[model samples]
Target: MKDNAKISSAVIKRLPRYRRYLSDLQKKNVDRISSNELSNLIGYTASQIRQDLNNFGGFGQQGYGYNIQSLYNEISSILGLDKDYKMVIVGTGNLGQAIANYTHYYKSGFMVSAMFDVNPKLIGLRINDIEVLDYERLEEFMQDNSVDIGIVCTNKDSAQEVVDKLCAGGVRGIWNFAPTDLQLPEGVALENVHLSDSLHSLAYYINRNSQMKDQD
Candidate 1:
């Protein structure tokens, strides 16, 4: 197995794509898949596929390609899908509700245990079977429950306050979906998810491609 030090983040990021496609293959009852076959589905070259997995260790056989189930398990284990993670969303706004409703991550090790919101209407309501607890009780609720990750889906005005409370409550990992850039203490893992930023990135590439075509 490849240690964290020896692996590249790009390789780690692609591991999810591998696991996702492998999972699809499992559902189709496909037992084994050659590198070229897998490459066609995932849009990666066969050699690139082999190189990526080689970073982690032996996965493919000489003549046979790879056992679909075995490769899925290996990639899943590498991505820490073998463990359980509890998450709490600190807002019940549109984005938070959408995430709670749409994401099936709960079925795959990362379960969203609770949701919090300041709006009186949203508090005590259930979205996607998970009850929205009042923000007033956040500290008490956190003290009683085990939250491994905190999702900040609040507005810019209230996002930092919610994050600070999560930090004070000893929560380690945070997924911020707010517009504000959050500052967290050292040792706390933070992932700032700016949907607008991603859209802008897409716009940039699209605009660039259009300009190139015009010049051509």
Candidate 2:
């Protein structure tokens, strides 16, 4: 595989979509696929798909195209989905609990090892058998467990503090769902899901489409 840092973020972002399509193809027992066939399924031009995949190396043959299972496995490995990751969630509110349940039911390689919350009623509860401990115990828990990811679902005011504690405890990555932006030290990976921003983007597209129709 080529150096990931040398690859553009746009290409990297598209990898998950490629993997998803490949996984669906695998479910249908499609053994081989030409770039053109994959393009039709994924809505990317064949040339674009070929170029994006070439960053990781030549995955498809000239005429034989790609072996579906092999390509699927390779993409899974590339996305680091082949490995198991243990995570802890800070905040046991609706969103946090929903994420916990979703990962537990659907994501086989990711485990929610613990949950923390400031609410006493929420504390001591178990979601999918993972106990919700006190927020105050978070630093201590982090000191003991080898957590790979920290999920922040708290309010924006508390998100940074929770993330700081998680980072101090040695989490290598953070999945942030708080509404505000956060800063992390060098080396720790951060992924943010800003719900309001996404909704705003959707509204912008909706308004643009309405205006275009009006013009017509």
Which candidate wins on lDDT? 2
How many steric clashes between backbone atoms does each model show? 0, 0
TM-score of model number 1:
0.90
Best by TM-score: 2
Summarize candidate 2's per-residue lDDT along 1-216 as a digit string, tens digits.
789889998897899999889889889988999999999999999999999999999999988999989988888888899999999999899999999999999977999999999999999898999889999999899998999999999999999999999999999999999999999999999999999999999999999999999999
Question: Which residue pairs in model 2 clash with each other?
Answer: none
State the C-alpha lDDT per candidate.
0.89, 0.94
lDDT of 2 at 93: 99
lDDT of 1 by residue, 25-102 (tens): 999999999999999999999999999999989899988999999999888888788999888998888889988876
Candidate 2: RMSD to truth: 0.8
Clash total of candidate 2:
0
